[model samples]
Target chain A: MIVSQKPIEIVNILTHSNRIKTFYLKLKDRIRVAPGQFMMVWIPDAEEIPISISYFNGSTMGLTIAAVGETTRQIHKLKIHDSLYVRGPYGNGFKIPRGINKIWIIGGGYGIAPLLLLAKKASSMNVKVISFLGARNKDELLFYDQFKLLGEVFASTDDGSEGFHGDVTTLVEKYLSVSKTDLMYACGPEDMIVKLIKLACNHNLNLQASLERLIKCGIGLCGSCCLDPLGLRVCRDGPVFPLKILVKLNELGCYYRSPSGVKVKLSD
Target chain B: MSINVSLGALSLRNPTILASGILGTTASSLIRVYKSGAGAVVSKSISINPNEGYKTPVLIDLGYGYINSMGLPNPGLDEMIVEFKVVKSKKVKLFGSIFASDIDEFKYLASKLTDYVDALELNLSCPTKMGVGLEIGKIPWMVEETTREVYKKSKVPVIVKLPPLVTLIDELTLAAEDGGASAVTLTNTAKAMKIDVFSKKPILQGVYGGLSGKALKPLSLACVFKAYEVLSIPIIGCGGIYSWEDAVEYILAGAKAIQIGSAIVSEGLGIFKKICIGIKKYLEENNIDKINDLVGLAHRR
Candidate 1:
């Protein structure tokens, strides 16, 4: 039997924004998961895409995906009980550092998916948590009430359509100014990751952030998800990495690849 | 129960080897695949200098198979020596794959890797530049000349890898044989593409890329079949092999050994041991004492 490929039935789907939806799947086996871990979702003939675990509970889990690309577009059409091939909980996920009682979680856009899981996990462990969730507008902010159940939420919208008028990073910077934390975590567009990396580095705070790259084989064999020069495979070495590894890559915020493998500056 | 197989000077305890371009970049990765139960592992095709490859969506999947245009990304030969040395120390069965846009580059790269690997697998199966005329590794004379040049400096067995985009698989196989190739790996990823109806354009950033996985299985098998008919040297079957059954099929189709790429990504590192266990069981059931007995068994009338 193929252990990696499991046929899971969709129990339900939670629509957040027009583009983002969370799929709750019922699996035969108990899926042990952690924040920042990603899964490779497969539909028989449509396409295969990598998704981060938005939430996990015993034999069931949720995947928060945006219907932006081809594979994700197909996933948005999936109905309940529809069997899709699911594999993993792959890659190195975020780990709570020792002696860290207070934590800050920051994210923007679809990047909010994994951070939501981190917030829930930290609060369940009785750790104090603060989250800064952002999007293009108030309508795009995700996991509003759920995040509130876990910790304080600072909602930011790029268009000033909600709480904060500027970017999420500004909210995070402002929060850190008012109150400091033992550790910080972030995920978002490359530019945001770059900005957060600098913020964490400057403050001398330990940071772990989940990154998204062109993932072909989530198990690390594909050689598609690489940060060149160091040859780090994002799928295996990380979807989540410590601040040190990101700093080592050197190209962190400066350059990233487009879907076609062309190098593009993060500023672009 | 011994699944050891030989193709010229190279020896593998099991017939399953990691194909080029699949987790073959670093020394740690090669060791990881070796520890996972691969009889041997091949490095991704390295060239004269480092390449950034195509773009972000360099690879994509369509359930049964994948289409990727990695554009042969590497840190070039100079930067790989340290990693190669570390890999050599692990003593994992390793074959190094080298590529070039011209004849001189082929000889130079092969010469540099002489001491780092057990053998050299020359990748002449690219789209353009320095093949017979149009297709690379397709023309018989081009194959012979390229193989001979690399074989000159390569101390170990020199194996030529061919793409399925050729007119005559046998002729190219024979050409490698004539040029003193130790073995030939049949078929690299076949060129393919997918279109996004929503975007009204190609799904891949690059309009065309190579197709692998179950989609290229038949093509690889046919190349091995035809190459076996014409050449006496060992032929390593690659492309789309996912399980032990796929491995056995390649052997039956006259492949001396087989390489697996896309399957490992789908099946995980466990695939190596899974394929090995399945082959041992198949051999035990068939009462076959040696793996070579099954190699090219289907060639009999």
Candidate 2:
């Protein structure tokens, strides 16, 4: 329920792609963050935006951001030692299922950031991780080598410049035909996640995914990120949801609210 | 155990209301609040066009309460109507709050929302640099004129939400009543500010924001008490109401209904049901049959 932002100094910055950079901040206090939880990051003189906790070693936290919007673009210009204000490792993060030995990790584009953290956590729990990473091309594939260090890595590029020749879902389908996985985890574009949900449902496999929305106030007070029909606030109720809840969200991949709370049709 | 109260033509199953701008942006949110047991809900103040509002740090938790300057961001009228249609279909008691810089815009907003909402709440007390909120509300003549103009066009009851200006509470309440308002929401947030010492800048993007929480209860209670002595219209007390004790105090001070805002942040949506249970028990213990019997009862002694 705390709304005040505490200043955290950026200790290091790593460029992952032309549009993505991973910034590590030194924490003044210990923040217990699960793999899928996010933080509201504020850049001085710019806007505050929600970013997933891509890496956390108890003392230093990493936020892998895509320079897609004004706030993130401003965040990209900052160097090491510049301070950024942050509040929360908020929302319910991904929960590792008990007694599971093997799991499939699927990520698309910049969505690969959070999955890497989940993979790391799973690896530590003695679970086998099989990751499927996808992007427009090999150049956009985020954390390929990092994800590889955890377990088996399957890469996909839309241009056929990587392991698979088509979208990540097509690669997942091909793998699913010959192999059986106990569970699946994902964080990516809504359309890709929607496709994964269908795949999981058809295969009778359980899937957990981290979602994205136009968030304001990053707390439940403002209803900017509330999902329709269910009235679940993406900020508090979840940024990560399971297949059961994901299927009920009628607005998924079809529409999204603009910053002003206007419901606009999602472009195909 | 009966807690139903009537505010003119409008009847609430209970007296607990969701104050404007807390969680009122979308239809799902309004319906969610209704499902959470709120007697009624007021929307975040909307304008004719989209407002992006202030940037990051628009709100902060001061431990005692909250200070926020959201700058009245909304998706404008047409988009809000789409959300209102869903809320109306579910039969939720919705009060559409609108803010404008002038009479013509207020009239237009009222006409558009009258069909969708149970009532219209004129938001004249949002603390911001925007010329619409306190700038117009601090003027007694403007309050009267704005209320009168909107009331004329509104088919549903009109509730004017005023600021908690200590010396002006009496005049503002009287102006609202004089201008044909069916009810007056005792107060909006008090204007306040906070600064970050290291950064040497205001915490909120808007230099000044409205303060709401436990800290505001006394000021708002005083405003309600003062207004009740002068105006015949029902007073809906808002600000810093977190518990049933706070709700009872407002009733004693002559508020017909109470709006819960900052408390929802700390206590969650369950506060509505909890408050009602407390009030029902208090009434039963006091040998009262209906909550309406407690309205302005403190003034008797």
Candidate 3:
């Protein structure tokens, strides 16, 4: 267990809704975390939750959180200069996979957090990165300015209140049709990842997904975090995996049996 | 100054080992954790065949703790053998944790892995996703049968990992002893769930999950105390040990050693060294000469 005694100062707070807020963290001790990786933000008495790192410079780390429950809602209470305990840059982050020149990053809701980091890193490397983001309307779409600095960005929403008045996946597909991207990275809803995997397969494009699996101990012990079939742990082996591996195993490549040791279906 | 605990023939440098299921799937990750100062590390649960465990949204943060139903996702025994072999070569006190859909598979997995590592951490506890998870730990007969088979086949010592949910600690502990377990690990993650208020849905693909982290420590400590009352075998205590104070509490509560989990995510690999130093300072200040003196002190009081 690595203890981060240094208190991370809240430099900025970007609110997405009544529930969600993005904390701009200035670390007491600077550490570099890759895109698609996450930080565990400790809110006093509220419990620590893993939020994906949306953006990072040398001294600061950005955490975009949806104020859904106690932890997130409590996190929303933080004012500028308020301090919290944080650790990580944990888990397997999205690798800029080799042999890819141009890449498309598709994100929805809070999923835009990690994708924004990916886009920024790609832009730094001059990887021709393009980001397609969506949310319920305009309010839910986060990191608008940061993502814009990364690449050519496309936006969408469920209601006609935002850029592309349709699903974010529609924007992703539209972009893929217009411009050729060698590789794609996606994170958001499970349905969205599944749908994107299907689209990539149908179109014969390379795809990688940062899956959202139930995890207890992020380091991979609790057995609570096992994925269904591919016999891989989302905590250890992934939060990010290539679509090629996802196509094989059951329940999105987890080996989950019920408490009775009975193999149950994902729906069950 | 930190306490040292034994799993069997192997002597750990410290009592705090990374509990089974924390970053043990790959050789690289295991090595990274070992270097972090855990006396030992347990591999993730591997089954008989290739298993893709669950779908996406497997993890969610709840008010109390985390709810995850990842299931027991892993490549089969054959693939795990390769991974375990690499782990063993690292010369750390590596342990293998395995789960099966049935008794026969558990026996088979134990037989294959027994020769490769210092010990076998049998996972009889897992909540949420399903399959031979919490059921085995919850039932004495199932624990006895599977542990018996594994103990008989293994060259190394066997440790049965139990969930904290068990209502009968004495019965389960005795069952493990009858099956020839060298030791028993108390308190796996607790079953839990998180709901998305916006979507009107369960946060995880599997819906329910196991809760770990600081929220689970008290219940886990109570379980350890209860199991220590009847079972003479060494018990490995786990569930939300983050600091030296937490580790010392487990010792006082009667755990031979403790395992650290969720803290690593929030803290990082540096936690191992920090805890070691903190424990040393505590011992030095308290004038305790040996780690054993701290064990079960609360029970004595």
Candidate 4:
């Protein structure tokens, strides 16, 4: 069946930080969405962008967005009761294997949005939840209090104003040395995720990461979000991928295609 | 049943071609589609210079189809050539689709891509306000001139993809034939738009875009059927082909081959193989020995 965008009104709005805000929308129909699967949020006539589902009940879903581009800036202007056209709950989401007692959730900047939902779900399943969240400063750390309520929460900031004085990956590395976890779930900047991949490898932990790309069509038809070598459509094959597949993607953390299909190198 | 069909100098194992602009930007994507059982694959429309394209809401699923105004985004000829080199090494039937506003630009793009591709498809019909797509395609003389110039400069076969909803299918087809086009792709996406009633604004960032999917099938088939009556060049039917029956209908309507586009959104790469299987089953059931024998069958009566 063909999937079309449904215009949903923003029921509530929450300001998370200076750059980030969460828009809670009520869907007309119930949608079964996983933690990392995203929605193509359209701010009519402005642009459409993929925002991961940060919160979902039966008919209500929340999209936590950072005002980084022009379209996102438009989304930030939206108030409660405003309509945003949305399609999907697209792409694959994070999968928690059975019999796993504990898992580490690593997130950085606004990436913590999707991981918060994961923490909530995992906590409900009686799985021990340890979250490591980082941002540029204490003010930027996302969902710290929410994560604390679920289980253990480690907050990091680049300027040393938060719980840990370094990057979240460094904090993860320090923790991995002292303790053990069944799996590691991450959603963050490419550099942070790449570092986490290495740590996961050394610690022999399976890692599942929600990656980002320049997505035009949330459906698989557009090659805008395709990864190199494997030619996997990031929109279809994954926004969330396992450690086994992530290790083979040469483009991961190296470069991402621009809107014009140019390979722009990821900034170090 | 022998499903192989030949379009001038280009031969396909089957008539199911991966339509341009659907996962055709990267070399890896082309290879992936090729391996998924498409007879050939067309690259996304490339241009002389890099284009950032329009901002999103560039595309929307209309339930029956999609309306998109991607604005011909590409990494310029230089980067595409690098991508083509990798695809060439894999030995897949590759068609380089290029779009330009003028004859000189078309000639330049065709010359640059001819070496790496099996054929060059002139994208004269993308529905954008960029003064290139339907703007150039609508003018019959411009179509003739661009096709003639590119065909002259290029060593491989040249295919002209025409815009849909034009006044005269015969004029466009004859113009391409007179300009030495080896084949013609009968119809690109129809110019269309959608609006958000709540916002009181057009859904696409570009205000207008091209429509593709199940809704476009009959329109495209009509174009192919009309073009078949007047043109000598092979007709490559494109627009809204989703299933095997759709492929058969296009073939009977006089299309030597068919292109699969928007359906890939729902069917994935496997659509190629699925449609091919369906066509073969159709031919076998109908007692047709070859797929070529079915072309223009609808006009036989």
Q: Indicate which candidate wins on DockQ.
A: 4
Better of 2 and 4 by TM-score: 4
DockQ of each: 0.17, 0.62, 0.08, 0.79
- Model 4 lDDT tens row, B83-118: 999998999899999988777888889888889999
Q: Report the C-alpha displacement of residue B208, candidate 1, in angstroms.
A: 1.8
Question: What does candidate 4 score on TM?
Answer: 0.96
True contacts kept of each: 0.22, 0.63, 0.09, 0.84
**Ranking 2 against 3 by lDDT, winner:** 2
Q: Lowest summed-lDDT stretch of 10 residues in model 1 chain A?
A: A256-265
For B17-52, candidate 2 gives per-residue lDDT tens digits of 999998888998899999999999999898999887
TM-score against native, each model: 0.69, 0.95, 0.60, 0.96
Candidate 1 lDDT by residue in tens digits, B243-289: 99999999988887889898866687789899889988998999998
As for DockQ, the candidate ahead, 1 or 4, is: 4
How many backbone clashes are present in model 1? 10
Candidate 2 colliding pairs: none
- The digit string of per-residue lDDT tens for model 2 on A81-154 reads 99888888788888888999999999998898888889999999999999999998887788898888999999
RMSD of 3: 11.3
Q: Could you give the candidate ranking by TM-score, starting with the highest?
A: 4, 2, 1, 3
lDDT score for candidate 4 against the true structure? 0.88
Residue A236 of candidate 2: its Cα lDDT?
83
Docking class of 3: incorrect
